[model samples]
Target: MSDRKRGSHRRVSTSPWKYVVATWFAGVLAAVGLGAVSPAGAALRSSLGLSTGELAWATSSITAVSAVLGIPAGWWIRRLGAHRALSWGLFVMSVATVAGATAGSWGMLLGSRIAEGVGYLLVFVAGPVVLTRVTRGGIRSAALALWGTCVPMGLAITAAAGGVLASRWTWNRWLALTALGPLIMAGVLTAVLPRLPRAPVQHPYRAVGAWKGALRLGAAYGSLSLVGVAVVMVLPLFLTERREVTPTAAGTLVALVCLGSAVGGLAASWLLRRGLALSSLVPLGALMPVACLPAFSAEFPLAVSGGAATLVLLVDGLLISAVFAAVPAAVSRAEDVDVANGILNQLGSVGMLMGPPVFGVAIAAAGWGAVAAATFVFGGLGTVLLLPGARTSGTGTAHGVARSLDAQDRVDVGEESEPLRKALDVSRPNRNRI
Candidate 1:
C-alpha cells in the first residue's frame, strides 16, 4: 500500500479503542447513578418518612419519564450527534444526582429522579451509536457484547458500596459523594471525546416503516427489563423478608446477583466469537430464567438458596446481554441504529417503570412465588415473541445470500454471451446493406 494509504489507515484505527473505552466508562457511570437508589431505598424511606409506594416511585419515576420521552430523545440524539448527547446526558445526570442528594421531601427526590431518567436516556441512546461508529467488523460485535456489561457492573458496584456506605454515613451524604462521579465523567467526555458528525436529515414518515422491526425487537428486549427490574429491586426485600437476612446482607447478596450479569455479558461475547446466532441465544436466555426461577424461589438452606439465586441471576445476565446483541442484528441500516436504540431504551423504560411496583404488588398479594410466576410468564412471552422475529431474520439472511448468488450467475452469463454476440454482429453486417 502507498504511504498515504497506510497513514490514513493508521489514523482511523488509532482512537477507536480509546473511544470505545471512554464511551463504555460513561455508560458505567450512568448505570451507577441509576442504581445508586436501589440499595439505599430503605435508608431513604426512613430518612424521608416515605411510604412503600413512595419508595418505589424514587426508582420508577426515572423510567416513567424515559418511557414517555424515549422516541423524541432518539430524534434529538440524531440531531445533536453522539459526543454532544453524551456530554449533555452526563451533565444532567450529575445535576439530578446532586438534586436527589439534597432533596428535602419525597416529592423532591422523585422529581429529581424523573430528570435523571431523561439524562440517562440521552447517554443510553448515544453510547451504543458511538460505539457502533467507532468499531468495525468482528471488533464491533465483541465491543457491543462487552458494552452490555456496563449496566450490571454499575448496579453491582453501587449497590455493594451503597449498602456498606449507607450503613456508616447518612444516605444523603452517600448520594452527595457519588454524585461527583458522573460530574467528573461528563466533564472529561466533553473535553476529550471527538465530536461525531450529524446524521443526515431523514423523512420521519419514511423512517417509520424501517423502524417497525427494530421496535418489535425492542419490545421483546423490554420484556426482559421487566424481569431484571423485578429481580434487582425486589431481591433485597425478598431476602430480608422471606430469607430472614439482615438488610446489609440482603444488599450484598443482591450485589452478587447483579455481578453475575457482568459475567453473563462476557459469556455472551465468547458465544458470539464462537459464531452463535443471536436468535438461538435469545431463547436460551428466556428459558434459562424459567428453569432457574423455581430453584431460586424455593425453600432451601441459606447457602443452597443463595447459590441457586446467584445461578438464576447469572443466567438472567447472560440473557440480558444476548438481548443487547440482538439490537444491532435487528436493524440492517446504519441510520436506523439510533432510532432503534431509542425505541429499545423507551420500551426498557416502560418495563423498568412497571416492573418493580408490579413485583411489589404481586409479592404483597400472594408471595415470592407470585413474583416467580410473573417472571416465568414474562419470560415465556418474550421467548415466543422473539422466536418469530429470529426466524424472520434468519430467512432474510438466506434470501439475501440467494439474491447475491443469482446476481452473480446473471453477471457470469452476460460475460459469456458478450463474445458470442460480438462474433454474430461481425458475420451479420450484410444486413446493413438491405
Candidate 2:
C-alpha cells in the first residue's frame, strides 16, 4: 500500500470532542436542507407551476435515492472515509440546492432534488460512524444518542424558518439562501475535521450474515421510524380536521411534539449513561406508541390530547436514540459500523417513504382512530424485530466497549490494521455480541 493509504486510517491522537461537534453541525445543515422543501412546498408549486404530484416527488426524491442506494452509499463512505465523504456530500448538497433555486420548471427542480438525495445519503451514513470512532465510552454513547435528534430538530427548525422565508421571498430565492448553509459548512468541515481512515474497498453484499443482521436491525428501526414520522406528519391535520383547532394552534402543537422528541433523545443519552439496557429501552419505546396513540385519539380536551401526543413523541424519540446507541454496541468490529449504518439508513428511507402516505390512507379510509390502530400494529412489529438483535451480548452497553478501546489506546480513528484488528479481537466482548 502507498504511504497515503497506510496513513489514511490514522486519526489525530487528541480527543475528538471538537471534531464530533463540528461533524454534527454539518450533518444538521444537510438535514435542514433535506427538510427545507416541506415548509416551502406551497411556494415551490406556485413559483414553478408544479402540480401536487410533482411537488410530492420533489420532496420524496431524497428518500427514494436513499432506499435504492443505501448499501452502496455505505461502501462509498468506507472507501472514501467519513470526513472526505461528508465534505463531498455537503458540496453536492450546496450545489444542488443552489441549482434548485434557479430552476424555472418543475422537472428542473425535481432533478436538483434527486442529486441532493445522494448527497444526503453520504452525510447521514458517514457522520455517526465518524462520531463513534472519535469519542470513547460514555462520551461515544452520549454523542451518538444526541445525534439521533438531528432529523426532528432539523425538520422543526427548517419548517419554521422556511415558513417565514416563504412568506417574504420566492421559493427559489429561499432555496438559494438555504444552500449557503451547506456551502459554508462544507468549507468548515474540509478545514477542521481530521482525515478518517479508509476501509478496504470490498462489496458489502458479499457478507451474507452481516447483511442479514443489518437488515433485521434496519426493519426494527425503520418500523419505529415509520410510526413516529407518520404521527408527527399528520398531527396538525388531525387536530385541525377532527378537533376544529385553528391552523396556527395546530402548527404550534406539532412544534411542541417535535420538541418533545428532541428532548427524548437527550433523555435516552442520560439513561445510557445510567447503564440502562437498550433491549429494555427498545421494547418500552415500541410499547409507548401502542399505548399513547389510542389514548391520544380519544375525545379528550384539546390540551389533554396535545399533551398525550407530546408524550408519544417523547417516547418515540427515546426509542430512536436507544436504537442508534445500540448500533456501535452491537457491531463486533469497528470497521462494520459503516455497513451497519448503511443498512439502517436504507431501511430508514423505506420508512420515511411509507409512513406519511400509509397514515394518510388510513385516515382517509376511517379516521384518526384508524391511524392510531395502524401505529400500534407497526410499533409492535418493530419491537418484535428489534428484540432479538437487542438481546446480543454487550448490545446494551456502549461504555463497556469504549472502556475496552480506551484500555488499548485504540480509540483514535483508523481502518483496522492487522495488529489493531487482533487487539480489537482480544478486547471485544463475547463473540455473540452481534
Candidate 3:
C-alpha cells in the first residue's frame, strides 16, 4: 500500500485531537441553522408576512427532521462512512443556507430549513462515531465528552451573533454570510481530519435489535430534553416576563449560560480520568432539575433564579458529555457504535421536538411553578434510565472495554456515559464496555 493509504490504517490515524476539533466544529456549524431561525423570526415574519406559528415551524422544522429521520440517518452514516458523511453534510448545509438566503416566502424558507435539517442530522449523528474512531483511553473520554458541547456551543454562538447580524444585514443577508463558514470548515476538515480505519461493514440494517442499554440512554436523553429544551427555549421569555429584563439582555445571558454546557462536558471527562466509575456519577444527573427548581420558580429572587439557570445549563452539558463518552461501552461490538448513536439520536430528537410546546402548555395551565414540576418528573425518569449500565467493567478505562470491532481487539471508550443516557457506555458496562 502507498504511504498515505498505510498511514490511514494506523490505529491512531493522523492527529486525533485535530480530527476531534474538526468534527466538533462541523457539528457546531450544523447547529447554527437550528438556532438561526429563532433569532431571525421577527425579521423573517415582517419580511415574508408570516405568522407566529409559521415562524415557530421555521425554527423547529430542522428539529422535526431530526426526530423523524434520526435513526435512518445513522444507518446511512454507517454505510456512507462518518468522515465522508460529515463532508457531505457540510456541503449540503452550504447549499441549504443559500436557499434560505434567497427565499422570498415562508414556503421557500421552510424548504430550505428542512434541507438544512437533513444536513444537520447527518453531521450530528456521525460526529461521535468519528471522535471514537480517532482517540482512545482517557483522551477518548475527553474527546467524546467535548463533542457533546457542539449543539449548545453553536446555539450560544448563533444566539449572540444572530441578532447582531440580523439587525445589521437583515436576516437573509446574515444567512448569506454564515454560509461561508461551513464551506471553509469542510475544506479544512478534508485536509485536517483523519481517515477512519476500516472495519467489517454491517449488512443492510434491521431496526429491531437496538441495544437495550442504548434504548434506555436514548430514552433518558429524550426525558432530559423534555426539561432542558423547555428551559432553554423558554428562558428568555421567562426572564423578560418574570424579571422585566430586556430582550437583548436576556438573549445575551442565555447565550453565555449555554456555553457552560462545555464545562459540564469537560468535567465528565475529568471525573473519568480520575478513575471514577460511570455509574457512581448518577447523582450528577440532578444538575438540570435541581437548578430548574429555583430558576423556573417565581418564589426565588432574580439573582438566585439566574444562578440556578446557569447551573442547570452547565450540568446539562456535563450530562450530555457523559452520555457521548459512555456510548461505546453501552454496545457490545464496535460496529454497533453508529447504530447505538442512531437510537440515541432518534429518541433525543423526539425530546427536542416535544419539550417546548409541552412546557408552554404546562405553564399556561399551572403557571411558572409548573415548569419545576414537569422538569422534576422528566429529570427523575432520565436519571433512572442511566442506572443499569454504570455498575460494570465497561464503566472503567477504555482498554478495559471489550466491545471493539473484532471481539479480541480492545478499542478505547475510556468509560463515562451517564450524561448522555450513559451516552458517552452507550450500553451496559459488563456486556460491551468499549
Candidate 4:
C-alpha cells in the first residue's frame, strides 16, 4: 500500500472507534435518562392521578414506541447515515428528557416518553450500523459489548444518583440532572461524529422485509426485556410499597442488578472466546428469574429481603446482560449480519414493549412475587426458543442454523440454490482481545 493509503486506513480505523464510543455513550445517556424515572414512577403516578394501567402504559410506552419505530429508524438511518441519525437522536432525546421533568399531566408525560422512545429507537438502530461499518474483528465485538454494557451501567448510575439527589433536592432537580446525561452525549457526538455518508433507499426496504427473522429475534428480545423490566422497574416499587424498604435500599437493589449485568457482559465476552453456543446461556438466563421467585416470595425480614433482592437481581442481571449481549452476537453469528442485526434490533423493540405491561399486570394482580413468577415463565419460553439449530459453530454460515451457532462458524444460506459463501467481510476476530 502507498504511505498515504496506509495512513488513510489507519485514520479511518481510529476515527470509527471514537464514534463507536460516542454512540455507546449515547446508550448510557438514554438509559440513565430513562432509568432515573423508574424509582419515582409511583410518585409520578400519584402526582398525575394515573390508574395502574395508565401508569403501566405511561411507563412502558417509551420502550414500546422504540420497538415499533426501530425498523423505520433503521431505514431512516440509511438515508441520513449513522452519524447524523445518531446526532439527531441525541438532540431529540435530550430535549425530550428535560421536558419530561415539567410534565404535570398523563398526556404530557406520555408525549414526552413517546419522543424519548423515538430517539431511543433511532439511536440504537444507527449506533450498531456505524460501529459495524467502521470497526472490524474483535473491535466489533468489543464495541458491541461496550454498547450493551452501557444500558445497565447507565441505569445503575442514574437510579442511584437520582435517588440520592431526590432525597435531598427536589424531583425537578433530579429530572434536570438526568437531562445532563443526554446533553453531554449530544455535545460529544457533535464534536466527534463525522458527516454521514448517504444511505441507500433499499435499507428500509430490506429491514421491513426481514419480518420473520425480526419476529423470532423480537420474541427473544421481548423475553429478555420482560424479565429485565420486571426486576428493574417493578422491584423498586415492590421493595418500597410491598416490602416496605427504604428508597435508598431499593435503589441499591436496582444497582445490584445493573452490576450483575455489567459482569455478565464481561463473562459473555469470555464465553464467546471459548466458542460456546449462545444457547448455552439461554437456560441460565431463563432460570435466574425462577431463582428469584423463591427469594421474592419468602417472608423474610427487611435486612434479609434487601440482601435477597440484591442477590436475586444480581443473578438475574447477569443472565439478562448475557441475553442482551447474546442477541447481537447471535445475530452477527448469521452470514447476513446486517439484516440479522436490523431484525434483531426491531425484535428488541417489541420485547421492550412487552416487558413493562407484563410486569405491571403481574404487580397489579398478584404483587411483586407474582411478577417474579411471571418472569420465570417468560424467561423459560425464551430458553426454549434459543435451542440450537443446525449451523456451523461461529463460522458465519449461510444456512438458517437454529442451534447455538457461534459467530465464527455461522453459515448463511442465501435465498437461492447456491453453496454458502462469506456474506459480509467483517473484521476478523482476535481471541486475545475479548
True-structure RMSD, every candidate: 11.3, 6.7, 7.1, 7.2
Q: lDDT values of the candidates?
A: 0.71, 0.75, 0.74, 0.59
The positional error of residue 174 in candidate 2, measured at the CA in angstroms, is 1.5
Question: Tens digits of per-residue lDDT for model 4 on 299-338?
Answer: 7666665555555544444444444343444442232343
Candidate 1 weakest ten by summed lDDT: 425-434
Off by over 4 Å in 1: 1-15, 286-290, 360-367, 388-434
**What are the runs in model 3 whose C-alpha is more than 4 Å off?**
1-14, 197-199, 202-210, 392-403, 406-434
Clashes of 1: 0
Number of the top TM-score candidate: 3
Model 1 TM-score is 0.82
| Model 2 RMSD, rounded to 1 decimal | 6.7
Global local distance difference test of model 2: 0.75
Candidate 3 lDDT at 409 equals 23
Best-matching candidate per lDDT: 2
Give the alpha carbon lDDT tens digit for every residue of 80-176 in model 1. 8877899899899889989999998998999899889889989988888776655544445556777778888888788778777877888888888
lDDT of 2 by residue, 171-225 (tens): 7788888899889988998877655556555545565764566677788778878
| Candidate number with the higher TM-score (2 or 4) | 2
User: How much lDDT does candidate 3 score?
Assistant: 0.74
